[model samples]
Target: MRSSPDPALSASSNAMLARARTTFDIEAAAVLGLKQRIGASFVQAVQKILEVRGRVVVMGMGKSGHVGRKIAATLASTGTPAMFVHPAEASHGDLGMIKPVDLVLAISNSGEVDELTVILPVVKRQGVPLIAITGRVDSTLAHHADIVLDSGVEKEACPLNLAPTASTTAQMAMGDALAVALLDARGFGTEDFARSHPGGALGRKLLTHVGDVMRSGDAVPRVVSGASFSELMREMSSKGLGATAVVDREGRAIGIFTDGDLRRQIETGADLRALTAADVMHVGPRTLRADALAAEAAELMEQHRITSVLVIDAAGVLIGALSINDLMRAKVI
Candidate 1:
């Protein structure tokens, strides 16, 4: 059976995508337009959350609730304590979740859910600070809130002009803007995010330093300057690091001797049986700080076209040695 085309719309092959693209562009533009809406109310909202010693309690119904959950998560991750509560569920014993020290952030496009309206009185009577995110500034929730954040959209992306498409995206983007602004104000840094994501790849990349994974001290292949080539080979073979550091009398790294050095020396007909360590060691090999990120070490190795780098402290003393394989095994790559 053949399906008939709709009589009300164009039968063009690109019509569906064209319409969707237009809708997406409009929604994206609306999100960008929200910048003009920031005012003292935004500051008040942040101040309310900052002053509260307890968690920020967010309540909403329908699409707004979904975005509220994400906003709450972002807030918690960025140094602000927050949680989402369903307004309909609050009518049940779930209202016990509310406490005096908390701030309430309510989300509802119309700001007029019957359940939310019912709870608004209790929220006001209990002295819980209320921050409202709604399309209508004069609506019931916004009128009662200590601070009102308007997430107004000219129209929804829904072709039917009813579904919460552009409206919901605007709400979510506004929530993110607020959360990020507050995060910056609170001085949340990369370390704070790393602490929250301690078990993930980002944690390993940022928190794991060269010292944590590098072959240290004796395990690092090393040969004193002027040592015989045989002794250098023995150090490299014994340590299995494929490379040995040639240190000056002060114990600072002066050069490095690697497997490549041996191959080059042999190609040049250099007497490996009689050459000293300094005769073959390459000077000014790559060196990284002990505190440098393992990820950065991996980048340097790739950029320098080498498989290893020496870890040195501020004093220029060789403290550890790292290889590409070690970082790969640790999954820092």
Candidate 2:
């Protein structure tokens, strides 16, 4: 038998959970506070990036640097050209990555990081526009920046009020806001996003067509409407789609004979050898277009409680066959 747990430990666990909740509330409020600050400066930042011929050069230090890297990635993926360069590295050799056609986006909570300040003059001398995301508008970085985005938070989420918590969250929200605004301004569409992420699941969803993954030509099982039970069984066995399309002389699908249909026929005490394909076939079976998406195929299969479907053309001619197994093989499921 197990002994009872200590009440003091349970109380400590509850106290920790409460502290976490308080921290989340503080961060949520900080992000909400940014809504009032998306004004003229934010618009100006978007306009400046759009107007620039070169990429957005993002620079920061410490935790701010981590947030800036994500901002740059988001901007790049959303149709804007952008890259992240560490302030310390920029002061050394990475400064060459910045050009007059490019724009600089520097982030700092205090707006007075030494590594960033040292390189600000060089950036200004190069005639590049500067956008600053900082906590203090009066700080040196903000004073020299061409555009200032205020990322101040009321208080740190840390209990000691020393760690970067709410302020970093505010900065990240500002970055995301800028990325989304620029993305909308550029009119980036789903196809463009698919082009950028061709190796991911999104690419598979947007690029894969039913024709690309379906069984076609000899792989598709077909039988004439008056075909005998032995002939239908041979086609099903040869093609392995667990179903065969019953077509007319014009190659148009009129009905389907499936494993389910065979089972229903047997359950009804029908003589298998006496029946032709028309006797056991289901008329006007569900079919999908060959140009439709693989995701669409998956949805149709699940919605109609089917394991496979026939792919047809504009004239309702059966051209291909697809199954849930094909979708799983293509990783569309």
Candidate 3:
């Protein structure tokens, strides 16, 4: 009962998709080309940035300026201290931001951006090492740079082949490669990364531990294994953790009783009043170490199809309890 699409519209859609695909292919090829360009100069740039006594100052004009800002952000977030300085601003007064111990990164597709080139003499006078990212190795920026990284591409994805499309793509890819190499050289680990990104989901996953979010002390519901069913229910309700740890005489957790277990018991028509904690609790219930990551606890909860879990110490003592709500509050869920 459905009609076919109009031929003209279909042709237009196909043409648009074709152009998009071509653009991606061109950009991909440009990025792939960059892998072969990474050699002594690339290593030198990374080393210079790492050994700098002050922050890395990145400079660029127009589209390269946009890419420069992103590169500075990536470097700062990944352990390297970096900042972007506009070339025009540097020529006016922003050059004061750069110290003699700082390293300069200059970005230009053609290596001929006047705004950037005008400050090369002043940068050199300050004895700052300059690293250039450019499409032309023999260009002005490259000639003056202490280290040169080639960001050349075969062609632009623009239909006119004039605008910066594949060129900027290559530059961005090269910048990322530089940042990652610096990160690896600095021995930057997840803990360092989490410190930089302390407000996001990634931060929560890396920095938040079970102990930080778990209910402890009086907030943790606990009962001895031999405790009566009424006593277990009272502990669970009063603590409101949706689960209670049933411990041995020595305070070692041996089982857990949750609201879900209560539902299954009621469905089976078990005599609630007659049962004790030992008779109703699930033995050897899934437990999380207090120091384990909240993300790990979230995964365990998902795997076991449970809403809550008990936290234990190395001695298997019931130290704390955590429910899905705790994870939600911690933004780890």
Local distance difference test scores for all models: 0.88, 0.92, 0.92
- Model 1 per-residue lDDT tens digits across residues 206-321: 89988889999689999888999889999999998899999989889999998987888889986688888888899998999988999989999999889999988899999899
The digit string of per-residue lDDT tens for model 2 on 1-333 reads 323445767877877777888899999989999997679999899899999999999999999999999999999999999999999998789999999999999999999999999999999999999999999999999988999999999999999999999999999999999998988999998878988997778888788889999999999999999899999999998999999999988999999988988888889897899889888889998899988999899999999999999999999999999999999999888
Candidate 1 — what's its lDDT? Answer: 0.88
Q: What TM-score does candidate 3 reach? A: 0.89
Q: Whole-model lDDT for model 3 versus the true structure? A: 0.92
Q: Return the top candidate by TM-score.
A: 2
Candidate 1: list runs displaced more than 4 Å: 1-12, 199-202, 247-252, 312-317
Model 3: how far residue 283 lies from native, Å: 3.1
* lDDT of model 2 at position 272: 96
Worst 10 residues of 2 by lDDT: 1-10
- Write the residue-wise lDDT of candidate 3 on 112-141 in tens digits: 989998899899999999999999999999
How well does candidate 2 score on lDDT at residue 300? 92
